[model samples]
Target: MPVFVKKVLAWGSLAFLIYFMAFRPEGAAQMFKAIGAALMMMAQGLGDFLTSLMT
Candidate 1:
């Protein structure tokens, strides 16, 4: 991607995160928790798949 587009996306994401954190701290926490859970699940699934392939 172009530098301009990258900067725009970075700034936009930062602004959105700040807004979410300031205006809805609880919601932001919950969202982060959900994201963590999803990532954990994905990791576990990948591990299981790798184990199955080896066995």
Candidate 2:
């Protein structure tokens, strides 16, 4: 995909997610919880990988 198209799609998806999270908090709580867990996992994995590289 072209860079602009990709950026637009990404931003659109983010906007939708934020919209629901803001206005439909009860309905979107599970999804937000999952996103939070995934982000935390990603951070921990990246930290471990970087530590290994430095050692």
lDDT score for residue 22 of model 1: 100
**In model 2, which range of ten residues has the least summed lDDT?**
26-35
Residue ranges of candidate 1 with Cα displaced over 4 Å: none
lDDT of 2 by residue, 2-52 (tens): 999999999999999899989999879987788899999999999999999
Q: Write out the backbone clash pairs for model 2.
A: none
Residues 1-55, model 1: lDDT tens digits: 9999999999999999999999999999999999999999999999999999999
Q: Tell me the TM-score of each prediction against the true structure.
A: 0.88, 0.54
lDDT of 1 at 18: 100
Top TM-score model: 1
Worst 10 residues of 1 by lDDT: 7-16
lDDT at position 20, candidate 1: 100
How does candidate 1 score on lDDT?
Answer: 1.00
